[model samples]
Target: MLWAGTAKADYRDSIAVLRIGLVETHVAATDPIKLEAIEHAFSGALGIPVEIIKLGSYAALIDAHASGRVGYAIHSARSFAATEAACGCVRAFRSPVAADGSTGFRSVLVARDSVTLPVAELKVGYSSEASISGWQIPHQAMRAGSLDLPKLVRAGSVGSVIELYQAGEIDGFFGWLPDVPGDAGSDPERLFGGWNRAAIETADPVRIIWSSQRIPYGPHAANRSLPDDLVEALGAFLDQMAVSAPGLLDIFEPVYGGGYVTPDPEEYHNIRGLVEALSDRKSAARIP
Candidate 1:
């Protein structure tokens, strides 16, 4: 859709208003206020009036992207991989660095400091059966160790699982930690950037009993249906935010830490494999 500098077509004729979809996967802010803040940053950077679409289900968000119901989405690596496979969506910009100044995070099994229980006997809480860090990675970890999935007490959200663990309702929960690598920092906000820290830390002193391999953060993906010029412009607008207003990066929930960077779609190949495996497991579970 490129044209001569002065011959550029007006985007308004094709779409009424630009739409950006945000998924409520791990974060705690369920209100519209968080969405509005994100809209402000993007509007300021792109000079485009944007509408916010808050999608609660990751699957629904991917379907929306594939169908072109929305042009952009701040997606999880697992969800992004699925959408890319389904509709050829491409990554525009990687997520800002996490609190530890790292581009990736890890999934962990957390429990209260005082609790002392065998891994197989503990009552475990998972955010959802569909969550990657909260469920998938942790499940795979258990299987690798010949450990069972533990008692199934699904909280439906990371915030909920942490709350349950703190209340002593469950012995432990599977969640995330910042990919600090050689650095050891335990700030929950830095560990899980997008969600509210206060909402996540229900226990005074929680400890990680298990940690998974590094999981890369999600990216801003554009649907294949978008014009090349518009896609390039959108990517440029995000790159500008990293330099001009890095602090504004906080407006994008679930994304905290370093500035944004351009990402190759291949970066998510490993995650896509995990998502595909999880899908197969789910299908097998349904057969019985």
Candidate 2:
């Protein structure tokens, strides 16, 4: 919440130590020495005793933060949204910016150039219902735009979707493109991950028919119960590290190693809404 200002030491009176939660599966395989080095670095920066609590799973990490057991956490976008929905007790302060200035990715509907049908008439294939970019984002975008829902097929996996599209079994498929800021057009060269790259490379003469809004990367969030000054201090320390101690960022978040940037408040709110809607739909479908 506090973006700028001198952080006061008043939090020391109420807090003895700060704890950060990380899911074990989320981190790379590393030795205890590296973990200790991270703790030491954070302690030195915060001027307080800092502890890293590695939980067995994301659920545990979410519960720990929701219950105020940990003061901070590195979360995936979905986990952070779930944590926010659980207690509304956390605030995402920073998220990683990719080396190419990409903050996130957009779900895109890519069709073969030969397909001349309207979007509503195209036979679109998605990886699965569980896929965010492949299914949810594009589905949500279509609903939001009041477009007629296309005939959708679940391809079981991204590989299958690509295979189907390449074989002309489907007119198009949903994939993701890197969300570079201020970019009005989609570039095949800027695909987010290998899946999109694979889709583009193997299926030539493709065009983006539709695209969703940017879906930001996950964030490092602080518990709302933490003191305002402490939160501000944490934010400042992280922002400073992006410039001074980028190696530390690599250790903490190797996926997006560029740097940390303050996230827009609404970034995860949209994710939360989508998650909740998906949850509700599943719940309703189960009522027999």
Scored by lDDT, the top model is: 2
lDDT of 1 by residue, 121-156 (tens): 778888887787788787776766744566769898
Task: Estimate the lDDT of model 2.
Answer: 0.82
Tens-digit lDDT track of model 2 for 114-178 = 88899889998888888888877777777777555889989999888878877878988888887
Residue ranges of candidate 1 with Cα displaced over 4 Å: 1-16, 24-41, 108-131, 141-177, 180-212, 285-288
- Candidate 1: pairs in clash: 97-258, 194-254
The number of the candidate with the highest TM-score is: 2
Worst 10 residues of 1 by lDDT: 185-194
TM-scores, each model vs. reference: 0.61, 0.88
**lDDT over C-alpha atoms for residue 202 of model 2:** 74
Reference-based lDDT, residue 106, model 2: 83
